[model samples]
Target: MSTGPLNPETSTSLPSPPFVHLKGIPNFRDLGGYKVAGSDLIVRRGYAFRCGEPTSATPEAIETIRGLGINHIFDLRSLPEIQKMQVAGTGPKTVDWPGVTRVFTPVFREESYDPVSLAKRHADYQSEGSEGMVNAYRTILTEGANSYSIILRHILEDARRSKNTAETALIFHCTAGKDRTGVLGALLLSLCGVPDEVVAEEYNLTEAGLGEWTELLVQAVLKQGAASEEGARRMVGARKDSMINTLAMLRDEFGGPENYIVTKCGLTEAEVAEIRHFLVVGE
Candidate 1:
């Protein structure tokens, strides 16, 4: 309900202050220090991050990630997705940060795929159109809400365990850190009544920050005469209109993200309160 850019003075920039552009990771970024709507409360900087895997990152990039002071990681990749990346639990497995915990929450079970074929099938389906993307968002809002209870619980429990500590950060990721993670971020902020434009701005940053691999996906599709780079870009990117449609779907089907979580995902208001207490600072 409020309209204001996050204060320029308090905003931090490090070329990657909010995101270290790992060579292999597409659109990895810090989710921190944003002012919460209708209140002085802000989402604390460095307390949470979202990104793809770090397997192929250079040693310097790895150190840069460690220097972010991240103490917890929640990997949302399916088992096969991790295996295909071949970076599962490898290079950036665990930094020297004491008490760091790694938790795995597969967005889809391994059984959901016929390992040899599903990845390519997913890629083909995703390359299709507004419908595929819209359905993806709808699936996310409906089934994807289920993942939040676990993530929210981890955040709450981690914060409780780390009380009075210097700082703790949790990073959540699926393969691209775009669709699944993006939905989670959008829903959490929406529940707080963050304006649609602000939420869209954050969601669309993934496109602005896309690394070479993302570019390659666009190029590959273009080379095949499937679409122009511009068109392909549009296909892979999140758009405001699509988000609105997805919200409409949520409203019609689940009544909204918060209600979907409560009624469908089984997250009680008490748990939601604890999540707010732990993550949304100064509330």
Candidate 2:
């Protein structure tokens, strides 16, 4: 995969189709077309996406999202974040995209860290360096297993009954789509037999997608009293090592993503098999 912004011209060569670009929506991509290791199977294209919050999605972008045939949207944002960003007069607790089912499965409680406070806290911790980021990722894995499990079950059940059509597409997102979304994307791909290196590479792509916004985010943090400019900059950027370390911890402590899902998330072996069956297509 090219380590740069997804170029539609050369998208044919990509592991997945070119990422869908929506004005004001960052870090959005089709999570398909990856070849499974040691097998002839590949993840089916157009069935799933990973993205950042679409609170600022333009009218055209909303149409584009609808056109993608996404019937299910798994929002991972805390309630406070949703309350703060949801468009007024649309609906309470959901984006007013007609014909789409939006599920609010927050990985973290609103009281733990709402979107407004998380940015400031992220800046503070990130200023200290990677340790803060590493700790955050660890917490997502250990403390957020129930939410992850719920997400997995939704995907599994959806895929199991899907007609293998684009209309069955599912997407999940957080505020920035770099941390929480990255972790879930990593977990899903890792569970499907993608190598850890490839998983980390995918996680790092968020930097390319969100590079401009990252600067703006860092500046916002600085204005809000980050300890240092350099620290805020470090916090705003994505690092392969952070995700690499998280995966390593998963391996060392839980055996692998499957085990973690089974033990931590309480998914059964049969359900895991069902998910693999629906997602991995042999060509």
Candidate 3:
């Protein structure tokens, strides 16, 4: 149980210093080096990474991922999407990423991911704006804990066996790395004592990190769905107010992130503490 924050003066910004340019992987970034408000601690880098789908990852992209020493990947897409990715492979039709394990713990496991239904849902929210985001995130927080519990259990197990979390650093992502992945990132960063503002900022980076993929998605939604241009963009945009509202919901209704994990996610307090230690190491 480390109550102390990570000291950045003497520590590298990231566990794997010198960010490399990654091709074919959109919205990929290490979750580290962030200054938690009113503390000397920064979020430890390299232990966690958030990215978009990896099926389109190039061989060079795979090398960059391998270089991170990311031993595990948590995919938040449903069974249908996971099956599609397995057939899609890691870029080339048949290439597989050796050594690293890919785990599927779908955020919407039982719910069918039908394109017509998904489009209709987005169309239904065309005028809702941040309200839609707020409702969507609330559902994610309420029902998605079971999916997250799987990752947390693995993280605790790994932390118990080793002090160095970097050797076994892991990634978690959904298709666009925005909604489901953003909530997961926010929870992890909050547990590390990052401020709500900082958490929102980190979440908002999803669009920029998505780069070309962002526009492509917006176009696809506009063409295939009945959503307005704003609504189409909203589907991919990580507006700060949405996350702010979600964090407030997390605190007010869920009794804060820690309690949420302990009660809803089925993690013990001791396991949660160990995960915090593994994620935030002092210099």
Candidate 4:
């Protein structure tokens, strides 16, 4: 239950696991307990969470989420991904989090479902280990800035309205609760002064968070002779190095996450500070 600074870089810590293994909701977990760099502060638990599509969450799970004091549930899946898919996990989300407001926030704009492009991306994953995760991270932060900003602003505003960040906990997710969700998670952690490497490790935890869906995703990622089992696994899995490279890109290109959110996402300095303050606790 306790997770503090493991080191300045490299967040390989397991004093306790952080995932919430709710039935039917893969990768559902708390996004807290991270230690902030150069301080004794740790990110507050029960304040933020991440998960995959929750359409399959059981009623009991919905009740659990409701009791978590969640003020908003941000759905970051693209419209097509959320509304058009026929698959069980990838399809439109139908389960609601009790009475919590579900904000349909698509972090990606609609685009033609180009099979060739997706195949090429998978090929890139096989040929290249990181599968161009840096670019993907960058695209979501930049091109998807508006949607991300909305999520951030809403969290801050809701906290103001409720006058309690803990009661205003926000849960956000994409299809697998990794890629797009991972990027936003990293940003928030980094804003709380988490080291870049540790942030990457947080992003990397998605592999385990995906739980049994790992095989399903690997199978779905595999396309006729496109990649070996290992390669397809790599495509479906969240690599720490990919997230590390993404963190480096954020530092080298965007001057770390704080500046990126301010310059690109258009959040005011006070708003960003308030979010950081709420996230990190203990002096």
- Compared with the true structure, the alpha-carbon lDDT of candidate 3 equals 0.70
- Model 3 regions more than 4 Å off: 1-20, 83-95, 112-119, 122-124
Candidate 3 per-residue lDDT, tens place, 1-283, comes to 1111111011122223312346655567888877766767777777788876666666767887888888788888876555444212322121257878888788898552322124456444445446667667777887789999998888888788777645577888776678788899999889888899989988887756766665566665566574577777766678887788889888988898899999999988998998888777655
Preferred candidate (TM-score higher): 3 or 4? 4
Return whichever of 1 and 4 wins on TM-score.
4
Tens-digit per-residue lDDT, 1-283, candidate 2: 1111221111222333437777656668887778789988887777788876665566777788788888778887777666554212122345567777888778876732422345566643554445667767777788778888888998887766773643477788876677778888888888888878878888887766664566556665566566777766666667877788888888888788889999999999889877877777866
Q: Write the per-residue lDDT of candidate 1 for residues 175-242, one digit (tens) a residue.
A: 55677788777776666556667777777776555544455545444444443456556655667666
Candidates sorted by lDDT, best first = 3, 2, 4, 1
Reference-based lDDT, residue 69, model 3: 84
Error of 3 at 228 (Å): 1.4
Candidate 4 stretches with Cα past 4 Å from truth are 1-17, 86-91, 112-122, 162-165
| Model 3 TM-score on a 0 to 1 scale | 0.84
Off by over 4 Å in 2: 1-16, 84-94, 112-129, 163-167
**TM-score for each predicted model, relative to the true structure:** 0.75, 0.83, 0.84, 0.86
Best-to-worst TM-score order = 4, 3, 2, 1
lDDT of 4 by residue, 1-283 (tens): 1011111111123223477656667677777988999989998888789987677776767777778787688887767665644224343444455568888777765731111124354346454667456666677777667878988888677557655346567788876777788888988898888887788788877777665566665665554344677776666678889888888888899988888889988998888888777677874
lDDT scores of the candidates, listed in order: 0.58, 0.70, 0.70, 0.69
The deviation in Å at residue 189 for candidate 2 is 0.4
Residue 44, candidate 4: C-alpha displacement in angstroms: 1.4
Query: Which candidate gets the maximum TM-score versus the true structure?
Result: 4
